[model samples]
Target: MSLFDDYHPLKGKMFQILKPDGTLHPNMKPLLSDQEIFNLYQKMVFIRLADQKALMLQRQGRMGTYAPIWGQEACQVGSGSVLQKGDWVFPAFRELGASLMMGVPLKTVYLYWMGNEEGSRAPNGINMMPVSIPVGTHPLHAVGTAWAAKLKGDKIVTISYFGDGATSKGDFHEAMNLAGVFKVPTIFFCQNNQFAISVPRKIQTASETIAQKAVAYGVDGIQVDGNDLFAVYAVTKEAVAKARSGGGATLIEGVTYRFGPHTTADDPTKYRREEDIEPWKALDPMVRLRFFLKGRGLWSDEVEKQVTEEAQQEIDQVVKEAEAVPTPSVEDIFKYVYAEMTPQLKEQMEYLKGTL
Candidate 1:
């Protein structure tokens, strides 16, 4: 049987392959070579460093407001590793790591946070969409992409990365239903980080788990240990394979946590308790992966030091690249909104110019 069927959300089984201490069940082990695992683990370290650098840049007035993916690296990296060249990713604002995994240049990600519209443009042959800022609207966009691919007889799968808070929005449900009805190649990936800005998950929904919501849409749902890299990769691999083979969409609840605030503009301390964060820290995805690699004699303190140093150097270069970009003109904003600027947009642009 498939992993999705074996650990359905209704069955109260949160799919887990690796324990927090770096042990894994042989039966559930994913097919990854030691070198590949090491490379992926290095990527996770680089992601964390890059995320921390973004936070620092925002604090120091070097960049604009940014969302820090402090505790959710594995969710992105694990699933991202399973993606093929033709697959597409529609991400919410907080997918810097996943974007990197999907072949988006770190320079491009930095440029986007640096407020350049040019940053939204993905590289040639990379089917990634522009990052969606609206809370929960892009899942529908993923479904639409999947539906189009289905119609064209394309074998690619489309996945949407969102948060638990998004599930409360109508757009998420609409996307889920449409994907289900059409039997499109879509993966609804929800990173349930336990908070919707200041509001907690309990107030967001009455459902026991977000994965169970898939039942209403006639799709498979599986709650997963999002921090367990092996489990996330295994489950996503299965879902992507199923979708590519003409199976319908699946809703994957990556049960993870956010160590940082929702975004740089918000203060998490005002709403969350310090004690509540302690337990989640133990499940630090990178640390466990490091442990696993070390156990296999692939990683050591020296290797970590070298990897971190290389990542920081790359981040420094990217930050410089983003900063070197020429500032956009005032007219550039209104010009890029549509193919031909609407009368209303033109008027608004004129008004803004007059005020300036």
Candidate 2:
């Protein structure tokens, strides 16, 4: 069957459970048990708090430019929860929560924002790559990894995270094309936050939706409610399973909103209207999940306080630890790029050493 075959009746519509009004959609049954749902909620809350703290750290000049993952907690946690220890995650710059879910240390995430190269290295056996900041380039790395896994008969899936803006890049097409041709077990997750820096998504591409582009590449294309944690989790879980079962690749376009500035260096007030953000706040993913949990009798006021406190304490500790890491030495920059330094690189390294 073609990846975009007629088997998936819910292709364009996708599957979503929790709604904006904090109620679960009747048609969408909970694939996870109540305990799992509650756990997801707690994880989302923790990740959100960590993201906020990172932003504050950036503003305080303790870290380099940071990307706030506010309003997209569900998108990260839901999708990230699907991976096993063996599956690999290739992340773009904004996926801190996803990285944490995939076994990256929270301190390392903070250390990354603090400009330490060591922070980029995932723990041994974590199967994650350093954050790729140059747009859609990392998808190719994901494809390569998936191809290698396929060759070894490992059945390990590789998921690449990028933004909607990345969909417009040549690398996105190349990676998608190669994955489709090779039938690699890969997932191209495009977080359609509707903006590429200052450019609104309307101008990003003429394509109606990023998922639709998958049809051309012979991949199962899907569009999910990015803010709905349950929906994101369900779709990603299915995609990962499909990949593992040799169903080839899938492209998931998560339609979500960005509530804050793109980064510390960005000023959204200059380009976007204030009203553009107001409606999305009403659709806040965290609030929806919290409401759902409350309806299920899994959340209480006391629990809220306890969880918030826990999240805050963890964030505080990560901040302190990340800040404590020593700054990279002048020579450290010249060390990692190549195994055997070229003559020009050696000369430049000597010059940097003399300057230091």
Candidate 3:
């Protein structure tokens, strides 16, 4: 039998309640009430503003390098806001906004970009890892964490966030196999933003869709409109609950776009076309949320001004805090390598201190 044939049929129902034009589908109307919708809109706006501020800081040489989350606000805020405090999150390099939603301090995130090691340290109760830059490797950690949680009989789930390119990696497949065999409480979320750096999605994989890959490991998978905040929130909510309840794993493919260059150092114009991006801008996550809010008389120019100013002030404060942190010492390099430093590492540390 075909892999998909054995998996649950999607039946064209991916649980999206909001549309790009700000209209709600009947199926989604009952899932979230008006107040909840307004709250979602507020969170999306806050993340978008913070993201833009981060880019500005990078350009001004205040940040080492910044990854813009401009277009993927819905995907981050939607999935992130749903996470409970005790749940573990394994994030790739691109999940800054999501991290913030999971109670990662905005200043720590900024400090990370400013080359501070403390930025990687999660708070006491947060089960989040330092951002993973190595493509597709963190999912294995997510699987292992989930296995631990399951063995301890904890009602916790480990959600690992990665991009479409990650799915092509051997680590990703191995992680999936392990999760399936052990019934690990893990959720694999793939933000398919259509490009893995300069390579298009088509060039990244031969599969019909990234979601279909879930079938190989006996898991449920779904594709959602990443730009639609409601869709992302609802689908991820279900996935998280299922994992915590011992329903095994899920692979959610959030189809979104990167509206900016991969990083401040790269030029996207060399790879993607302007014509392709123009239309997608109209379907911007923030704009759609604004439209929805206005329809319900929850949006106003006064509120916009107030929110923008508040976000700016908060970002500015975080930037200052990040800048105030001291640089790492020579001992720092050797100290965290293990519980106890090896003689070779101790000698190297002494040599570095003398060279300085």
Candidate 4:
């Protein structure tokens, strides 16, 4: 049976294959080759370190406030790794790992948080959109892109990454409605990390499961164990395939938690407790996945040491490259607002330059 059918939202099912201890489920199998699993594991480790580095950069006053995807690596990598060439990803601001998985350079990711507009440009042929910082708005853009692609007869699927907070926004609902009516090939991937900044998930909506919200839009939906790499991979891969084959949209709620503060500007301790996060520490996506790999003889302490050192070296270089880029010119601030700058904007730009 398909993942969606097997774990229907109303059935209140949450799909999972790997237990917190790295043990596999009796009947379910991972949808990855041994080599593929190892590759993804490496990617996850790199991302985890990169995430910590971003936090450090922010704390050191080198970068601006940043969102930490500390504990959501599986949700990002598993879903991103499955997309084929030509598929597009629309990321909310927190999707640093997912963007990298989708082929965005680590330098660009750093540049974005470093306040460079040049960072907005993804490489040609990689259709990832610029980060949408506004809460819950990019779902509409994703659906629109998907609709346009469908109209143009392009065989590409589009996926949008959002948090649980996004579900409370009107854009999410509107996008779901449109995707359903038109049967556009898109995936609404909600990384439901249990909080929208300081607000808990329960306060955002009364819905028992975010996936069940898909029922209102007449689309397929499922809740998966966001920490389980195998489960996330299985669900996302199936959803992508279904959408690619003209099966319309699917809403996937990956139930996970963020082990850090929501962003550099926010503190979780003010609202939640260490006790709350203690349990999830055991369920860390990295820990279980690492355990699974070690059991298969694909990973070891030496391997981890090497990977971490290599990741640190690579990320350190990316930081240098990002910082080396020239700062934006004064004109850059006023030039992109319109095809031609208005006299008012021109006057403001000139006034600012005069002051500088």
Best by TM-score: 4
RMSD of each: 1.3, 2.1, 2.9, 1.0
Tens-digit lDDT track of model 2 for 1-356 = 53235324345565577898778788667688989988888888888889888888888888899998888788888899999989999999999889989989899888888888888999999988998889999999999999999999997999999999999999999999998899999999999998999999999898888888887888888888899888888888888989999989999888899888999999999999988889898889988877888888988899999999999998898788777777888778888789988889989999988986
Model 3: lDDT of residue 93: 87
Higher-scoring candidate on lDDT, 2 or 4:
4
lDDT per residue as tens, model 3, 1-356 = 42223334344434466787888877455257778877767777777877887888889887888777778888888888778878899999888878888888988888788777888998899877998989999999999999999999988888999999999999999999999999998989899888888999999998878887888888888887888888888788888888888888888888889998888888999999999899888878888888888888988898788877877788778778777888777697789989999999999999999998
- Number of colliding residue pairs in each model: 0, 0, 0, 0
Best by lDDT: 4
Every candidate's lDDT: 0.91, 0.87, 0.84, 0.92
Worst lDDT run of 10 residues, candidate 1, spans 22-31
| Candidate 4 lDDT, 154-186, residue by residue in tens | 989999999999999999999999999999999
Q: TM-score of predicted model 2? A: 0.95
TM-score of model number 3 = 0.92
Per-prediction TM-score to the true structure, in the order listed: 0.97, 0.95, 0.92, 0.98
- Residue ranges of candidate 2 with Cα displaced over 4 Å: 1-14, 353-356
Model 1 C-alpha RMSD vs. true structure (Å) is: 1.3
- Among residues 3 or more apart in sequence or in different chains, the pairs in candidate 1 whose N, CA or C atoms overlap within 3 Å are none
